[model samples]
Target: MAVLTSWVWLLAGCLSAAVAEDSNVSALYPPLWEESPEQISDYRLEDGKHIMDPWVITDRMGMYRILLKQTAPYFASYAPENEQNILWGLPLQFGWQYTTGRLADPTGMTDCGYEAGDTLCVSVDSWWADVNYYLSVLPFLAAVDSGILGIPSDQISILPPLKDQMMFCYTVSGCQSAFPEAMGRWSAFFQYMQSPSSDFDGLLEYLWAAHTSSLEYPTRAFVDRYAYYSDQEANFEKNWAIAVDYIAATRLPTTLSRVHSFQNGLPPRVLVDTDIAPYIADFTPLQNKVLVLLNVLGNIHHFTGSLFLTAWESAMSTKAARKLFLISFEKFLETSS
Candidate 1:
């Protein structure tokens, strides 16, 4: 039920990097996260005019401005050798985002254990959500294009999240260790689905060169990969149908429509923005937001089924058929390490 607006971002330091930041791309990051004008006077002039040195960022009410004004960006600048970005008690809180009407307001879903603003986790059934994942990846890709990730455009896949190949079910920690069993199975399944061949070498090159990225820096990889797969208008619907049938007949529940709204859900993929100017050339804000929202919901449905399969603890045998519930979730490590 949440909407994702544009997510591109840039990385310039405090007041010092103003010229370098502005001279580069304007489309990659949100206004608050990018370089900006020095709005106030830094000195007095002999000609009766005041000299101005504007602030570098625009998030006057958000963390960028407020935090930088009070302190420097890096902990290295701290007077005490061991200090971090904590004012009062919050240590580097990203600007406010609460699930209720306001950014930090409580949702009162403690009974359901659903906290607003805490990332929503859903288990999806038979649905296609690459579109959603692509939306999440765009911002990171933008950063990469902007030269922030320090990799040649061709070498970006050497980046963390995509380097080791596998079927990643969700963003729990780093994908492989987080859901080893599920990723193991999904990786095998995707291989079976694609059967990488000489004919599909284009896809392989795209994946190795572009589709993959480090979760630590997945933004650029996502933008290119998403555009590649979805834009090609590949046979995604047919493949998803096959996934639905496999789940329905041999897996849990009867069909892919059985979605889980609570307890588990799809998560957004994170990325960095290094390259963004060219993308802004083709940017269409209204359409992009709508696409991201649709992807988020669809991913939720698909992930729920995967969670149920991984969470299936025991075998079932009964005169009236069988059922498996997460009877003792404590048996498994519930939190992502």
Candidate 2:
């Protein structure tokens, strides 16, 4: 009984440590960080155009930075410091991806995103970077179109990637033409953001609708890219994609604090073939268990239909209920084990 008590204490300590990590928010920023442009005037102008190259990691992040700054007024009434902005998740997640080397080329053929070559480079070969492009670049274009950026859509031009030029759309009109559903959804989100009636939950609903829609095409298009990564990384990518749908269905407001806490459960870096979760020194037992659960859920998602997800989405519709459900579920699983 004493030995069991000691183990319980250790587990509790580890969980406490994870919770404490939320205060170390600087870990969420990418390496070699610099202040990003908060407005269009900060960007370089080329022949009456605001020039942006979304292929660069910082440049891509700049888009989100600008977006949050522009949209802060809409969310100010909900909470102070723009902490209530649902859009915080996008830039925060992107920064986490970069800090963890998910933005690096996993193919080992290029040094794009490697500190030795070009630290700021966001490789087109990276599945994380490519999928993130849809999340970052598309919404940015839509913001311009919706007049949130205070610029005409055509006044801003995003540079294209080298190989997959045709896969991405550089201009608002081009994106609207190529990705009508995603563009429309994003435009609607901006419209709603500008609405006085938009509360936190309403913003979350609109934001997730647009966020999930933005992910649809890229997740399908980048299926082939997963082959370049390890089994663990590939599975993680799929799991994260499916998890978005689950979260979107809940309409949970992914505020800054909530997102930071939630990301603590995610793997800090791409898992290599040789890295065993149980023995990973940096991860606690709870984190290892979470990783294992992710793999199981990822596999189940692959082999099964959306019925389970639908049921889960229906059962836990609110953030408070979802939290209670998770706590109760964990307690049940622990007792059974």
Candidate 3:
């Protein structure tokens, strides 16, 4: 009986040891694996430059610099005719032809599909493309600011306002309440542009017309008419003051000081005295870059006005457009000097 009890105790000890071993194995191979070997291998390859020799890295960078230098002029031109063929030219041509009744009717109709005719179609497409081009360059400009050119990302908050304004213009439902479902916001914009006056006053006039034509009639008309002449005037003045304050805050001179400080921190081997001094001089690299960005923005703004006039006739939202206009004008004043 004593011998049997000893064997039972020994068996119990073995069972406990087996359970402990299983728990230890499970702890080592937990269910939540941190990363797969494949993911780790890919990360290492990208982060370590594929473990290439230093000479190979240098050679690749040098080749890239050479390519960028070679292509600089093409990009720098006011309008590269060669690139025009690829970017705006073909798209514009196709858009113009399709909308102008020169091509077969897109809807398979025998007659010109639109009562307003080819002009309206052309106008819509042109406006769409102009907006597209303006928005597309923004990312590239942001990349230049942060990556290659070394301008701090925080300094250039201008892009977001402009983007928001463009989006509001494209998608806002305020105009939809006036125009028919078929007409859409584009028609409202087109009508505004077609008006002889295309400024704030012009916008007021367009709003009045929309108000009168709307099914809501007297209520919408009365409200908008009074608001346009009175509230809008006060709003405009207030916005102008705010924009002036922003300009005072973000003006390029302040930014130049920041850029200078950043440049000062670089090792002597990486940058020379000549490079540093010239960057602060009249028409500095910083200035040149800002000028390029501003110039593009200004040109697009002006081009949009032109397209609006061509398509229907002119525009800006209250806050975004006003701020952009003030900033661009201020930069232009500095550039003129």
TM-score of every prediction relative to native: 0.18, 0.85, 0.15
Sort order, lDDT high to low: 2, 3, 1
The positional error of residue 141 in candidate 1, measured at the CA in angstroms, is 16
Tens digit of per-residue lDDT, candidate 2, span 1-337: 3532332333222222112224544454433335677678778999998889887876787898888779888888877677667787888788889888999888879889898988888989899999999999999999988888888976787998879789888888899999999999999989987887766666777888899999999999989999998887787788778867765765655667656655665678788877676677787566676666556556655666866566556655667755554454345436533
**Runs with alpha carbons beyond 4 Å of true place in candidate 2:** 1-34, 317-337
- Which pairs of residues collide in candidate 3? 193-313, 193-314, 194-312, 194-313, 308-313, 309-313
lDDT of 2: 0.75
lDDT of 1 by residue, 25-132 (tens): 223222233332222222233344332211101212132233223322222332232122222111111211111111211223321213442232211110122222
Candidate number that wins on TM-score, 1 or 2: 2
Worst 10 residues of 1 by lDDT: 7-16
Best by TM-score: 2
Output the lDDT of residue 153, model 1: 32
Better of 1 and 3 by TM-score: 1
289-336 in candidate 3: lDDT tens per residue?
Answer: 432333333343365653422221112334444344434534443453
